[model samples]
Target: MSGTVTLGMVPVVLTALFFVLADGQITNDFLIAHLLAMGVPVIGPAAIWYWDARVFPTFVDQSADLAANPTAVQRVGDKYKAIFSTRSWYFVVPWIALIVGLTVLNLGFFETVGITGAGDPAFWVYLLFAAWWGLITGIGLHGAVTAVRAIRAVGELDLQIDPLHPDGLGGLSMIGHLAIWTTMLISLGSLALPLAFLLGTEGGYRAVVYLAVGVYIVVIAVSFVYPTVYVNRRAGEIQERELEKRREKIRQLQTQAANLEEADGDTGTIDEVATRLEIQRLRDEFNEYDSVSLYPLSVGIIIRLVSSLFLPIFFTLIDIYLGQLL
Candidate 1:
């Protein structure tokens, strides 16, 4: 996990550092414009983390003790389900930044570069960041889908209380950890893209930067999110099937329990049959729910990271080539 994060972030940190140092040398309005342009990409993910740390976490105390409480578990589960249901505030921030950032760019640079329009450098830059925002949002959407599927699957599982299975706590930890890291890496990488261009653009590169972001967003939204939605849909179907199995087990248990009580301890045969039936029924119910394990989380998390990583690498390389053109 540490290795995945380090490998993912090294390029971003290096890129940001390079951009920050190079920002000092750029003095022309066009060049300064490029530096400012780089910042647009960072807005959404940074805003997300800030909001989560400061605001979102306030709503739920996710401690182990809290989880142990049945009421807390239900409430927290509902809270998370609701949280992931809507398009997060993170998605809106990019558009806000784009409009606000471009407006400022327009007012300040319009006279020199002209207002954003066809074949205009500023227009292309705006488009680039817009694309980047879309790509990032799509990746985030995919991650959310993956996480939801994982959460639902785990929620369905009838974790054992025995010492041997340990209630499958290890599986839960693994899924949670995967989601957390994938979320962080994707966010960081999104920020690094524009930052790279800000420090490196020669001149007249803003449009190309925007163009790069724009193209990436199109590809990701079309390819990654759409298919992720399908996979998540299938996962939901599987979860539903497991839920039905549990319900059926519950029905069977209730019927047997009723028949045993009706016998009223008359014959030893009936008592023995009742006792054996109860044990089997209970075990069957437990196993029925236990089958809804963490497999979806594991698979979805892996897919999310793989796709998320692919987008950033593609954008970085494409943006580099675009910068060269400028």
Candidate 2:
């Protein structure tokens, strides 16, 4: 993530240096815009990578416990390796295409905005800035994609479901937490800075900014939530199977108690009492299933996800409304 962000910033920094040497003065707005563009893409991925790095040891430890065999351990390592590896062309290609398309669109936008003048060095510089922006943004997006793929890969892991486990999902709860962090990384890294740039700009582009915000909300919501769906489904299935097993046990015990009651009188009373105790134990087991969440997302994660989407818009609105007042 750091390497990708650094590569993206090199062009802008070099361009800014060249312009400073040649023209002696660069427009403050242009500098600010380019810096924001470059910085926006870096923030989300950097934060996520930092988090991954910090928690990685814990992940490895948990993975080792889950992956009892050497093959499973190797697979777990491969999945982690894939998170940072650029070996996946399927992931890299779309980002490259997006960069190309956005570069063209931004060039046209600069031209339309009168920032691109014929044969002007400044215009070319601005175009380069746009391209750099797209490149970094693409890299950030690629990281997000990698994170999602990692989560999906986890779903394929041969995991043991221990019904007695405290987390209720057989210690696979880490997967859900990882999903939340990855979603946050994508949200803040990919969307926040660009939207900040758009909202900060002047003109009749408020409508454009709002439109972008709408798209950001929808995309982030999906990206954040979708990675957890498969895992959530798996958890639900496990919970259901466990519940069914307990229910079956309860039914058998009840049937035995009913038969004992119909058979005799005094001898059946002790048997019925023992059967009732067993039935109560099974019922407690069934009730414990309620403690197990099919969807691993907690209320806090949902709040954080919502906040990630709304906080930017909230501040943008403040800036807009307050700017009008001033």
lDDT of 1 by residue, 1-326 (tens): 34434433433443344334332332344444344334434444553444344323432332222133545445554565455545545554564565445444443333334433345454444444445544445434544454445444434433322212333432233333334443543444454464445433433457766676666555444433433344345444544655566566767766666677676446845775766677676566556444544332455555665666565666567555655665
Clashing residue pairs found in predicted model 2: 44-189
lDDT (Cα, tens digit) per residue for candidate 2, span 178-219: 666656665654333443444336433556556766776666
Model 2 worst lDDT window (10 residues): 191-200
Instruction: List candidate 1 stretches off by more than 4 Å.
Output: 1-42, 49-66, 70-188, 194-266, 295-304
By TM-score, the best candidate is 2
Each prediction's whole-model lDDT (CA) = 0.46, 0.59
Candidate 1 versus the native: TM-score? Answer: 0.35
TM-score of model 2 relative to the true fold?
0.69
Winning model by lDDT: 2
> Number of clashing residue pairs in every model?
10, 1
How large an RMSD does model 2 have? 5.1
